[model samples]
Target: MAPPLDPEVLRAALVTRGSGWTEVEHHDSIGSTNARATRLGRPWVVVVADHQSAGRGRLARRWDAPPGRSVAVSATVPVPASGAGWLPLLTGLAVTEAVEATTSLAAVLKWPNDVLLPSDDDRKVSGILCEVVTARAGPLVVIGAGINVSQSRAQLPVETATSLLLAGARVTESTGTDLVVAYLQRLADRYAALVEAPVTGGALAGPTGLSGLAAEYRTRCSTLGRRVRMTRAETNGAIDVVGVAVDIDAEGRLVIDGPGGPTAWAAGDVVHVRLDG
Candidate 1:
Protein backbone atom coordinates (compact mmCIF):
# COMPACT_ATOMS: atom_id res chain seq x y z
CA MET A 1 0.00 0.00 0.00
CA ALA A 2 1.12 3.53 -0.73
CA PRO A 3 1.86 5.99 2.03
CA PRO A 4 -0.64 8.67 3.07
CA LEU A 5 -0.62 12.00 1.21
CA ASP A 6 1.67 14.50 2.88
CA PRO A 7 0.72 18.14 2.38
CA GLU A 8 4.31 19.20 2.17
CA VAL A 9 5.13 16.40 -0.20
CA LEU A 10 2.18 17.16 -2.46
CA ARG A 11 2.89 20.88 -2.30
CA ALA A 12 6.52 20.31 -3.13
CA ALA A 13 5.58 18.20 -6.12
CA LEU A 14 3.26 20.98 -7.33
CA VAL A 15 5.51 23.95 -6.56
CA THR A 16 7.08 23.93 -10.02
CA ARG A 17 3.81 25.13 -11.56
CA GLY A 18 3.33 28.07 -9.18
CA SER A 19 -0.36 27.36 -8.51
CA GLY A 20 -2.34 27.58 -5.28
CA TRP A 21 -3.71 24.31 -3.91
CA THR A 22 -5.88 23.28 -0.98
CA GLU A 23 -6.27 19.80 0.45
CA VAL A 24 -9.16 18.61 2.53
CA GLU A 25 -9.57 15.62 4.79
CA HIS A 26 -12.95 14.76 3.31
CA HIS A 27 -15.50 16.40 1.04
CA ASP A 28 -19.18 15.91 0.44
CA SER A 29 -18.08 15.14 -3.07
CA ILE A 30 -15.27 16.06 -5.44
CA GLY A 31 -17.91 17.05 -7.94
CA SER A 32 -18.53 20.05 -5.74
CA THR A 33 -14.95 21.19 -6.29
CA ASN A 34 -15.92 22.93 -9.50
CA ALA A 35 -18.52 24.97 -7.68
CA ARG A 36 -16.14 25.76 -4.85
CA ALA A 37 -13.33 26.78 -7.16
CA THR A 38 -15.66 28.97 -9.14
CA ARG A 39 -16.56 30.89 -5.99
CA LEU A 40 -12.85 31.31 -5.23
CA GLY A 41 -12.30 32.62 -8.75
CA ARG A 42 -8.61 31.83 -8.76
CA PRO A 43 -6.82 30.33 -11.72
CA TRP A 44 -4.90 27.12 -11.08
CA VAL A 45 -6.39 26.89 -7.62
CA VAL A 46 -7.02 23.21 -6.83
CA VAL A 47 -9.22 21.39 -4.31
CA VAL A 48 -8.45 17.81 -3.39
CA ALA A 49 -10.33 15.41 -1.18
CA ASP A 50 -9.36 12.15 0.55
CA HIS A 51 -12.89 10.85 0.25
CA GLN A 52 -15.97 11.98 -1.66
CA SER A 53 -19.33 11.23 -0.13
CA ALA A 54 -21.43 12.36 -3.07
CA GLY A 55 -19.12 12.25 -6.07
CA ARG A 56 -20.86 12.28 -9.41
CA GLY A 57 -20.28 11.45 -13.06
CA ARG A 58 -21.96 12.08 -16.38
CA LEU A 59 -25.75 11.66 -16.14
CA ALA A 60 -25.65 12.21 -12.37
CA ARG A 61 -24.35 8.77 -11.42
CA ARG A 62 -22.74 8.56 -8.02
CA TRP A 63 -18.93 8.33 -8.19
CA ASP A 64 -18.06 6.94 -4.80
CA ALA A 65 -14.74 5.19 -4.15
CA PRO A 66 -13.09 4.03 -0.96
CA PRO A 67 -11.36 6.69 1.08
CA GLY A 68 -7.62 7.18 0.59
CA ARG A 69 -7.54 4.71 -2.26
CA SER A 70 -8.19 7.12 -5.09
CA VAL A 71 -7.35 10.64 -6.18
CA ALA A 72 -10.05 13.29 -6.57
CA VAL A 73 -9.00 16.76 -7.59
CA SER A 74 -10.53 19.84 -9.15
CA ALA A 75 -8.91 22.92 -10.70
CA THR A 76 -10.30 26.07 -12.21
CA VAL A 77 -8.90 27.79 -15.32
CA PRO A 78 -9.86 31.10 -16.88
CA VAL A 79 -11.44 30.92 -20.27
CA PRO A 80 -9.15 31.61 -23.19
CA ALA A 81 -9.38 35.08 -24.77
CA SER A 82 -9.81 33.43 -28.15
CA GLY A 83 -13.38 32.47 -27.21
CA ALA A 84 -12.75 28.82 -27.92
CA GLY A 85 -15.33 26.72 -26.08
CA TRP A 86 -13.50 23.53 -26.77
CA LEU A 87 -11.08 24.00 -23.90
CA PRO A 88 -12.56 20.98 -22.13
CA LEU A 89 -11.54 18.80 -25.05
CA LEU A 90 -8.03 20.20 -24.77
CA THR A 91 -8.05 19.34 -21.07
CA GLY A 92 -9.01 15.76 -21.92
CA LEU A 93 -6.08 15.53 -24.31
CA ALA A 94 -3.72 16.80 -21.65
CA VAL A 95 -4.99 14.17 -19.17
CA THR A 96 -4.63 11.37 -21.70
CA GLU A 97 -1.06 12.45 -22.34
CA ALA A 98 -0.27 12.68 -18.64
CA VAL A 99 -1.78 9.28 -17.78
CA GLU A 100 0.16 7.68 -20.61
CA ALA A 101 3.36 9.35 -19.46
CA THR A 102 2.98 8.31 -15.83
CA THR A 103 1.49 4.80 -16.02
CA SER A 104 2.47 3.80 -19.56
CA LEU A 105 -1.12 2.59 -19.87
CA ALA A 106 -2.98 3.22 -23.11
CA ALA A 107 -5.68 5.69 -22.00
CA VAL A 108 -8.65 6.05 -24.30
CA LEU A 109 -11.04 9.02 -24.26
CA LYS A 110 -14.78 8.58 -24.55
CA TRP A 111 -16.81 11.36 -26.09
CA PRO A 112 -16.86 14.71 -24.30
CA ASN A 113 -15.13 14.01 -20.97
CA ASP A 114 -14.53 10.38 -20.02
CA VAL A 115 -11.15 8.61 -19.98
CA LEU A 116 -11.43 4.84 -20.31
CA LEU A 117 -9.05 1.91 -20.45
CA PRO A 118 -7.91 0.56 -23.81
CA SER A 119 -8.85 -3.04 -23.09
CA ASP A 120 -12.38 -4.29 -22.47
CA ASP A 121 -10.95 -6.60 -19.83
CA ASP A 122 -10.33 -3.59 -17.64
CA ARG A 123 -12.76 -1.00 -16.25
CA LYS A 124 -12.65 2.78 -16.27
CA VAL A 125 -9.57 4.12 -14.59
CA SER A 126 -10.43 7.83 -14.69
CA GLY A 127 -13.21 10.31 -15.27
CA ILE A 128 -13.35 14.06 -15.95
CA LEU A 129 -16.08 16.59 -15.17
CA CYS A 130 -16.04 20.12 -16.59
CA GLU A 131 -18.36 22.93 -15.60
CA VAL A 132 -18.45 26.60 -16.55
CA VAL A 133 -19.09 29.09 -13.79
CA THR A 134 -19.98 32.68 -14.49
CA ALA A 135 -18.35 35.22 -12.20
CA ARG A 136 -17.95 38.97 -12.02
CA ALA A 137 -14.58 38.63 -13.74
CA GLY A 138 -15.93 36.42 -16.52
CA PRO A 139 -16.41 32.73 -17.24
CA LEU A 140 -14.19 30.46 -15.18
CA VAL A 141 -14.17 26.78 -16.01
CA VAL A 142 -13.63 24.14 -13.38
CA ILE A 143 -12.23 20.75 -14.41
CA GLY A 144 -12.51 17.89 -11.95
CA ALA A 145 -10.81 14.50 -12.25
CA GLY A 146 -11.24 11.22 -10.36
CA ILE A 147 -8.72 8.44 -10.63
CA ASN A 148 -8.61 5.00 -9.00
CA VAL A 149 -5.22 4.49 -7.42
CA SER A 150 -5.05 1.90 -4.59
CA GLN A 151 -8.43 0.29 -4.04
CA SER A 152 -9.32 -3.39 -3.91
CA ARG A 153 -12.28 -5.24 -5.38
CA ALA A 154 -14.32 -5.22 -2.17
CA GLN A 155 -13.81 -1.48 -1.88
CA LEU A 156 -15.37 -0.74 -5.23
CA PRO A 157 -19.09 -0.24 -5.66
CA VAL A 158 -19.41 -2.39 -8.76
CA GLU A 159 -17.60 -5.37 -10.22
CA THR A 160 -17.27 -3.48 -13.52
CA ALA A 161 -15.04 -0.89 -11.83
CA THR A 162 -11.26 -1.03 -11.45
CA SER A 163 -8.31 0.72 -9.88
CA LEU A 164 -4.65 1.23 -10.77
CA LEU A 165 -3.44 -1.00 -7.96
CA LEU A 166 -5.95 -3.75 -8.77
CA ALA A 167 -4.67 -3.74 -12.33
CA GLY A 168 -1.14 -4.47 -11.04
CA ALA A 169 -0.03 -0.94 -11.86
CA ARG A 170 2.40 0.37 -9.31
CA VAL A 171 1.68 3.91 -8.13
CA THR A 172 2.93 5.21 -4.84
CA GLU A 173 1.27 8.14 -3.09
CA SER A 174 3.92 10.58 -4.29
CA THR A 175 3.86 9.31 -7.85
CA GLY A 176 0.09 9.29 -8.05
CA THR A 177 -0.30 12.80 -6.67
CA ASP A 178 2.49 13.99 -8.92
CA LEU A 179 0.73 12.52 -11.91
CA VAL A 180 -2.44 14.51 -11.15
CA VAL A 181 -0.45 17.69 -10.63
CA ALA A 182 1.42 17.18 -13.88
CA TYR A 183 -1.80 16.82 -15.83
CA LEU A 184 -3.25 19.98 -14.31
CA GLN A 185 -0.06 21.88 -15.06
CA ARG A 186 -0.08 20.67 -18.66
CA LEU A 187 -3.70 21.70 -19.00
CA ALA A 188 -2.94 25.17 -17.65
CA ASP A 189 -0.08 25.54 -20.09
CA ARG A 190 -2.23 24.58 -23.05
CA TYR A 191 -5.01 26.94 -21.97
CA ALA A 192 -2.49 29.75 -21.53
CA ALA A 193 -1.25 29.24 -25.06
CA LEU A 194 -4.75 29.22 -26.45
CA VAL A 195 -5.58 32.48 -24.71
CA GLU A 196 -2.51 34.27 -26.07
CA ALA A 197 -3.08 33.23 -29.65
CA PRO A 198 -4.87 35.56 -32.07
CA VAL A 199 -8.57 35.04 -32.55
CA THR A 200 -9.10 32.70 -35.48
CA GLY A 201 -12.90 32.50 -35.11
CA GLY A 202 -13.04 28.70 -35.09
CA ALA A 203 -13.09 25.81 -32.65
CA LEU A 204 -9.31 25.58 -32.32
CA ALA A 205 -7.08 27.26 -34.83
CA GLY A 206 -3.47 26.76 -35.91
CA PRO A 207 -1.71 23.63 -37.16
CA THR A 208 -1.38 22.23 -33.66
CA GLY A 209 -4.74 22.75 -32.00
CA LEU A 210 -8.07 20.97 -31.63
CA SER A 211 -7.80 19.28 -35.05
CA GLY A 212 -4.52 17.72 -34.01
CA LEU A 213 -6.05 16.90 -30.64
CA ALA A 214 -8.90 15.06 -32.34
CA ALA A 215 -6.44 12.99 -34.32
CA GLU A 216 -4.65 11.84 -31.19
CA TYR A 217 -7.94 11.08 -29.41
CA ARG A 218 -9.11 8.97 -32.35
CA THR A 219 -6.08 6.74 -32.17
CA ARG A 220 -6.44 5.98 -28.46
CA CYS A 221 -10.21 5.49 -28.49
CA SER A 222 -11.24 1.80 -28.53
CA THR A 223 -14.83 2.79 -29.21
CA LEU A 224 -13.95 3.50 -32.80
CA GLY A 225 -14.57 0.80 -35.41
CA ARG A 226 -17.10 -0.97 -33.18
CA ARG A 227 -20.86 -1.18 -32.88
CA VAL A 228 -22.45 0.58 -29.90
CA ARG A 229 -25.77 1.48 -28.36
CA MET A 230 -26.64 4.90 -27.00
CA THR A 231 -29.39 5.55 -24.45
CA ARG A 232 -30.72 8.90 -23.42
CA ALA A 233 -33.02 9.71 -20.53
CA GLU A 234 -35.57 11.40 -22.75
CA THR A 235 -35.67 8.59 -25.27
CA ASN A 236 -37.78 5.53 -24.59
CA GLY A 237 -35.45 3.21 -26.48
CA ALA A 238 -31.78 2.81 -27.25
CA ILE A 239 -30.42 3.90 -30.60
CA ASP A 240 -28.15 1.52 -32.44
CA VAL A 241 -25.18 3.32 -33.93
CA VAL A 242 -22.06 2.02 -35.58
CA GLY A 243 -18.91 3.51 -34.16
CA VAL A 244 -17.06 5.23 -36.92
CA ALA A 245 -15.35 7.00 -34.01
CA VAL A 246 -14.33 9.71 -36.36
CA ASP A 247 -13.29 13.23 -35.46
CA ILE A 248 -15.47 15.23 -33.11
CA ASP A 249 -16.76 18.50 -34.50
CA ALA A 250 -15.89 21.93 -33.17
CA GLU A 251 -18.62 21.89 -30.52
CA GLY A 252 -17.32 18.52 -29.27
CA ARG A 253 -20.21 16.52 -30.70
CA LEU A 254 -19.52 12.91 -31.74
CA VAL A 255 -20.09 11.72 -35.27
CA ILE A 256 -21.40 8.19 -35.76
CA ASP A 257 -22.88 6.17 -38.61
CA GLY A 258 -25.72 3.70 -38.16
CA PRO A 259 -27.42 1.34 -40.57
CA GLY A 260 -29.72 4.18 -41.52
CA GLY A 261 -26.72 6.19 -42.76
CA PRO A 262 -24.94 9.01 -40.82
CA THR A 263 -26.02 10.64 -37.56
CA ALA A 264 -24.63 13.12 -35.10
CA TRP A 265 -25.61 12.41 -31.54
CA ALA A 266 -25.51 15.54 -29.47
CA ALA A 267 -25.94 13.91 -26.08
CA GLY A 268 -26.58 10.37 -24.78
CA ASP A 269 -25.12 7.52 -22.77
CA VAL A 270 -22.61 5.56 -24.89
CA VAL A 271 -22.26 1.79 -24.54
CA HIS A 272 -19.96 -0.37 -26.68
CA VAL A 273 -21.63 -3.46 -28.10
CA ARG A 274 -20.00 -6.84 -28.63
CA LEU A 275 -22.46 -8.22 -31.16
CA ASP A 276 -24.69 -6.65 -33.80
CA GLY A 277 -28.30 -7.61 -34.53
Candidate 2:
Protein backbone atom coordinates (compact mmCIF):
# COMPACT_ATOMS: atom_id res chain seq x y z
CA MET A 1 0.00 0.00 0.00
CA ALA A 2 1.13 3.52 -0.77
CA PRO A 3 1.59 6.09 2.01
CA PRO A 4 -0.22 9.41 2.30
CA LEU A 5 1.03 12.59 0.62
CA ASP A 6 2.81 15.36 2.43
CA PRO A 7 3.70 18.53 0.52
CA GLU A 8 6.85 18.94 2.53
CA VAL A 9 7.94 15.39 1.86
CA LEU A 10 7.33 15.81 -1.83
CA ARG A 11 9.48 18.94 -1.78
CA ALA A 12 12.29 17.03 -0.11
CA ALA A 13 12.10 14.18 -2.60
CA LEU A 14 12.28 16.59 -5.51
CA VAL A 15 15.25 18.33 -3.96
CA THR A 16 17.06 15.06 -3.37
CA ARG A 17 16.52 14.10 -7.01
CA GLY A 18 18.34 17.25 -8.13
CA SER A 19 15.59 18.07 -10.56
CA GLY A 20 16.71 21.70 -10.90
CA TRP A 21 13.08 22.71 -11.07
CA THR A 22 12.72 26.45 -11.35
CA GLU A 23 9.52 26.52 -9.34
CA VAL A 24 7.02 24.27 -7.62
CA GLU A 25 3.94 26.22 -6.67
CA HIS A 26 1.22 24.55 -4.66
CA HIS A 27 -2.14 26.16 -5.16
CA ASP A 28 -5.31 25.85 -3.14
CA SER A 29 -7.26 26.23 -6.36
CA ILE A 30 -6.36 27.25 -9.86
CA GLY A 31 -8.08 27.60 -13.19
CA SER A 32 -5.59 25.28 -14.91
CA THR A 33 -2.11 24.05 -14.09
CA ASN A 34 -1.11 23.96 -17.76
CA ALA A 35 -2.19 27.54 -18.23
CA ARG A 36 -0.34 28.54 -15.14
CA ALA A 37 2.85 26.80 -16.31
CA THR A 38 2.64 28.39 -19.75
CA ARG A 39 2.28 31.86 -18.25
CA LEU A 40 5.21 31.30 -15.92
CA GLY A 41 7.79 31.28 -18.78
CA ARG A 42 10.22 28.73 -17.39
CA PRO A 43 11.41 25.35 -18.54
CA TRP A 44 11.50 22.27 -16.29
CA VAL A 45 8.96 23.64 -13.85
CA VAL A 46 6.05 21.96 -12.08
CA VAL A 47 2.71 23.37 -11.01
CA VAL A 48 0.38 21.44 -8.75
CA ALA A 49 -3.00 22.34 -7.40
CA ASP A 50 -4.91 20.84 -4.50
CA HIS A 51 -8.11 21.94 -6.18
CA GLN A 52 -8.81 23.12 -9.66
CA SER A 53 -11.40 25.81 -10.01
CA ALA A 54 -11.49 25.24 -13.76
CA GLY A 55 -9.36 22.33 -14.94
CA ARG A 56 -9.56 21.70 -18.67
CA GLY A 57 -9.21 18.75 -20.99
CA ARG A 58 -8.86 18.42 -24.76
CA LEU A 59 -11.37 20.52 -26.73
CA ALA A 60 -11.60 22.80 -23.68
CA ARG A 61 -13.90 20.59 -21.63
CA ARG A 62 -14.27 21.14 -17.92
CA TRP A 63 -11.90 18.98 -15.78
CA ASP A 64 -12.63 20.33 -12.31
CA ALA A 65 -13.21 18.12 -9.26
CA PRO A 66 -12.95 18.15 -5.50
CA PRO A 67 -9.48 18.80 -4.11
CA GLY A 68 -6.95 16.48 -2.39
CA ARG A 69 -8.17 13.26 -3.98
CA SER A 70 -6.63 13.80 -7.39
CA VAL A 71 -3.24 14.68 -8.82
CA ALA A 72 -3.33 17.66 -11.19
CA VAL A 73 0.14 18.60 -12.38
CA SER A 74 1.68 20.41 -15.34
CA ALA A 75 5.26 20.71 -16.50
CA THR A 76 6.95 22.80 -19.18
CA VAL A 77 9.79 21.57 -21.37
CA PRO A 78 11.91 23.59 -23.77
CA VAL A 79 12.34 22.87 -27.48
CA PRO A 80 11.98 19.12 -27.73
CA ALA A 81 13.78 16.90 -30.23
CA SER A 82 13.61 17.57 -33.96
CA GLY A 83 10.70 15.14 -34.29
CA ALA A 84 9.12 15.36 -30.89
CA GLY A 85 5.49 15.81 -31.77
CA TRP A 86 4.86 12.40 -30.28
CA LEU A 87 5.44 13.76 -26.77
CA PRO A 88 1.77 13.32 -25.90
CA LEU A 89 1.81 9.67 -26.88
CA LEU A 90 5.06 9.06 -25.02
CA THR A 91 3.67 10.79 -21.98
CA GLY A 92 0.66 8.49 -22.02
CA LEU A 93 2.88 5.43 -22.06
CA ALA A 94 4.96 6.75 -19.21
CA VAL A 95 1.84 7.47 -17.18
CA THR A 96 0.45 3.99 -17.75
CA GLU A 97 3.66 2.40 -16.59
CA ALA A 98 3.86 4.66 -13.57
CA VAL A 99 0.32 3.86 -12.46
CA GLU A 100 0.91 0.14 -12.86
CA ALA A 101 4.05 0.34 -10.75
CA THR A 102 2.06 1.65 -7.81
CA THR A 103 -1.11 -0.41 -8.24
CA SER A 104 -2.36 -3.72 -9.55
CA LEU A 105 -4.96 -2.64 -12.09
CA ALA A 106 -4.00 -2.86 -15.75
CA ALA A 107 -4.21 0.54 -17.41
CA VAL A 108 -4.88 1.03 -21.12
CA LEU A 109 -4.57 3.98 -23.45
CA LYS A 110 -7.34 5.47 -25.57
CA TRP A 111 -6.59 7.00 -28.92
CA PRO A 112 -4.75 10.30 -28.76
CA ASN A 113 -4.38 10.69 -24.97
CA ASP A 114 -6.59 9.04 -22.35
CA VAL A 115 -5.91 6.27 -19.81
CA LEU A 116 -8.71 3.79 -19.42
CA LEU A 117 -9.29 0.91 -17.06
CA PRO A 118 -10.38 -2.55 -18.12
CA SER A 119 -13.91 -3.86 -17.34
CA ASP A 120 -17.44 -3.12 -18.57
CA ASP A 121 -17.46 0.05 -16.53
CA ASP A 122 -15.10 1.70 -19.09
CA ARG A 123 -14.38 4.68 -16.93
CA LYS A 124 -11.52 7.14 -17.44
CA VAL A 125 -9.11 7.39 -14.52
CA SER A 126 -6.47 9.67 -15.98
CA GLY A 127 -5.85 12.02 -18.93
CA ILE A 128 -3.04 14.02 -20.49
CA LEU A 129 -3.30 17.40 -22.16
CA CYS A 130 -0.50 18.87 -24.28
CA GLU A 131 -0.24 22.48 -25.40
CA VAL A 132 2.44 24.19 -27.49
CA VAL A 133 3.75 27.70 -27.06
CA THR A 134 6.05 29.22 -29.66
CA ALA A 135 8.84 31.54 -28.61
CA ARG A 136 11.86 33.12 -30.25
CA ALA A 137 14.01 30.49 -28.60
CA GLY A 138 11.76 27.71 -29.87
CA PRO A 139 8.63 25.78 -28.96
CA LEU A 140 7.75 25.22 -25.35
CA VAL A 141 5.56 22.22 -24.67
CA VAL A 142 3.37 22.11 -21.60
CA ILE A 143 2.21 18.66 -20.54
CA GLY A 144 -0.61 18.45 -18.05
CA ALA A 145 -1.67 15.26 -16.28
CA GLY A 146 -4.56 14.40 -13.97
CA ILE A 147 -5.06 11.21 -12.02
CA ASN A 148 -8.01 10.20 -9.86
CA VAL A 149 -6.36 8.94 -6.69
CA SER A 150 -8.92 8.60 -3.91
CA GLN A 151 -12.40 9.78 -4.87
CA SER A 152 -15.30 7.37 -4.49
CA ARG A 153 -18.22 6.80 -6.85
CA ALA A 154 -20.48 9.07 -4.85
CA GLN A 155 -17.96 11.85 -5.17
CA LEU A 156 -17.61 11.55 -8.93
CA PRO A 157 -19.47 13.95 -11.15
CA VAL A 158 -20.53 11.28 -13.61
CA GLU A 159 -20.69 7.51 -13.85
CA THR A 160 -18.25 7.54 -16.78
CA ALA A 161 -15.48 8.80 -14.46
CA THR A 162 -13.61 6.77 -11.84
CA SER A 163 -10.85 7.02 -9.28
CA LEU A 164 -7.96 4.73 -8.38
CA LEU A 165 -9.36 4.24 -4.90
CA LEU A 166 -12.81 3.31 -6.20
CA ALA A 167 -11.14 0.84 -8.56
CA GLY A 168 -9.66 -1.09 -5.61
CA ALA A 169 -6.35 0.75 -5.49
CA ARG A 170 -4.45 0.71 -2.21
CA VAL A 171 -3.33 4.28 -1.80
CA THR A 172 -2.91 5.93 1.59
CA GLU A 173 -2.73 9.68 2.10
CA SER A 174 1.05 9.52 2.68
CA THR A 175 1.70 7.59 -0.53
CA GLY A 176 -0.15 9.83 -2.93
CA THR A 177 2.63 12.39 -3.21
CA ASP A 178 5.29 9.75 -3.79
CA LEU A 179 3.19 8.07 -6.42
CA VAL A 180 2.66 11.38 -8.20
CA VAL A 181 6.34 12.24 -8.03
CA ALA A 182 7.32 8.84 -9.35
CA TYR A 183 5.04 9.31 -12.33
CA LEU A 184 6.50 12.72 -13.01
CA GLN A 185 10.00 11.30 -12.94
CA ARG A 186 9.07 8.62 -15.41
CA LEU A 187 7.60 11.24 -17.71
CA ALA A 188 10.72 13.34 -17.43
CA ASP A 189 12.99 10.45 -18.33
CA ARG A 190 10.94 9.58 -21.39
CA TYR A 191 10.71 13.19 -22.46
CA ALA A 192 14.45 13.58 -22.16
CA ALA A 193 15.07 10.51 -24.30
CA LEU A 194 12.63 11.78 -26.92
CA VAL A 195 14.44 15.07 -27.06
CA GLU A 196 17.65 13.17 -27.64
CA ALA A 197 16.50 10.76 -30.36
CA PRO A 198 13.14 11.68 -31.84
CA VAL A 199 11.69 9.40 -34.48
CA THR A 200 12.48 11.26 -37.67
CA GLY A 201 11.68 9.17 -40.74
CA GLY A 202 11.66 5.82 -42.61
CA ALA A 203 9.70 2.87 -41.15
CA LEU A 204 8.26 5.04 -38.39
CA ALA A 205 7.04 7.97 -40.44
CA GLY A 206 4.09 9.80 -38.87
CA PRO A 207 2.20 12.90 -39.93
CA THR A 208 4.40 14.73 -37.44
CA GLY A 209 7.44 12.46 -37.83
CA LEU A 210 6.85 10.52 -34.61
CA SER A 211 5.74 7.18 -36.00
CA GLY A 212 7.56 5.09 -33.42
CA LEU A 213 5.50 6.61 -30.67
CA ALA A 214 2.41 6.17 -32.81
CA ALA A 215 3.09 2.45 -33.18
CA GLU A 216 3.46 2.06 -29.42
CA TYR A 217 0.26 4.03 -29.02
CA ARG A 218 -1.59 1.58 -31.27
CA THR A 219 -0.52 -1.43 -29.24
CA ARG A 220 -2.18 -0.09 -26.06
CA CYS A 221 -5.12 1.73 -27.64
CA SER A 222 -8.60 0.28 -27.20
CA THR A 223 -10.15 2.62 -29.76
CA LEU A 224 -9.15 0.42 -32.68
CA GLY A 225 -11.47 -2.39 -33.76
CA ARG A 226 -14.54 -0.53 -32.51
CA ARG A 227 -17.28 1.44 -34.23
CA VAL A 228 -16.67 5.13 -33.79
CA ARG A 229 -18.37 8.47 -34.36
CA MET A 230 -16.10 11.31 -35.36
CA THR A 231 -16.80 15.02 -35.43
CA ARG A 232 -14.51 16.53 -38.04
CA ALA A 233 -13.80 20.18 -38.75
CA GLU A 234 -15.12 19.72 -42.30
CA THR A 235 -18.51 20.86 -43.51
CA ASN A 236 -20.04 17.43 -43.14
CA GLY A 237 -19.53 17.71 -39.39
CA ALA A 238 -20.28 14.51 -37.52
CA ILE A 239 -19.90 11.30 -39.52
CA ASP A 240 -20.08 7.62 -38.84
CA VAL A 241 -16.65 6.01 -39.04
CA VAL A 242 -16.77 2.33 -38.27
CA GLY A 243 -13.76 0.15 -38.83
CA VAL A 244 -10.90 -1.59 -37.16
CA ALA A 245 -8.36 1.02 -36.08
CA VAL A 246 -5.76 -0.01 -38.66
CA ASP A 247 -2.91 2.11 -37.33
CA ILE A 248 -1.73 5.58 -36.46
CA ASP A 249 0.31 7.26 -39.18
CA ALA A 250 3.75 8.81 -38.73
CA GLU A 251 2.19 12.18 -38.12
CA GLY A 252 0.23 10.76 -35.20
CA ARG A 253 -3.00 10.70 -37.22
CA LEU A 254 -5.49 7.85 -36.80
CA VAL A 255 -6.01 5.52 -39.73
CA ILE A 256 -9.35 3.80 -39.96
CA ASP A 257 -10.86 1.62 -42.68
CA GLY A 258 -14.56 2.19 -43.04
CA PRO A 259 -17.30 1.63 -45.61
CA GLY A 260 -16.09 4.83 -47.26
CA GLY A 261 -12.60 3.32 -47.55
CA PRO A 262 -9.35 3.94 -45.70
CA THR A 263 -9.17 7.38 -44.12
CA ALA A 264 -6.54 9.19 -42.13
CA TRP A 265 -8.12 11.31 -39.43
CA ALA A 266 -6.04 14.39 -38.65
CA ALA A 267 -8.20 16.11 -36.12
CA GLY A 268 -11.58 15.49 -34.52
CA ASP A 269 -13.46 14.13 -31.53
CA VAL A 270 -13.79 10.34 -31.61
CA VAL A 271 -16.26 8.32 -29.58
CA HIS A 272 -15.88 4.57 -29.77
CA VAL A 273 -18.86 2.24 -29.57
CA ARG A 274 -20.04 -1.28 -30.21
CA LEU A 275 -21.32 -1.83 -33.74
CA ASP A 276 -24.43 -3.58 -32.47
CA GLY A 277 -25.18 -0.68 -30.19
lDDT of each: 0.66, 0.72
Instruction: Compose the digit string of candidate 1's lDDT tens values, residues 1-277.
Output: 4444455655665655345343322243354655566677766677776666666676767778776787777787666655355566667777777777777576766665567665436477777777777877677777877777788888877777777767666686575666776787677766766665444664455656655555665666666666667778676555545555554665566677767766777677777676744
Which candidate leads the pack in TM-score? Answer: 2
Instruction: Supply the global lDDT for candidate 2.
Output: 0.72
How does each model score on TM-score? 0.83, 0.85
Q: Give the clash total for candidate 2.
A: 14
Residues 1-277, model 2: lDDT tens digits: 2233466766775645556455667776688898898888678778887667777887766786677678788888886646455678778887777777878778887777788877426688887888898655467888898888888778777778888887777776655676667777777776755555534343334443344555666777888777676676563565757666777766567788888888888666777766566
lDDT of 1 at 146: 77
How far is 180's C-alpha from truth in model 1 (Å)?
Answer: 1.5
Supply candidate 2's per-residue lDDT for 11: 70
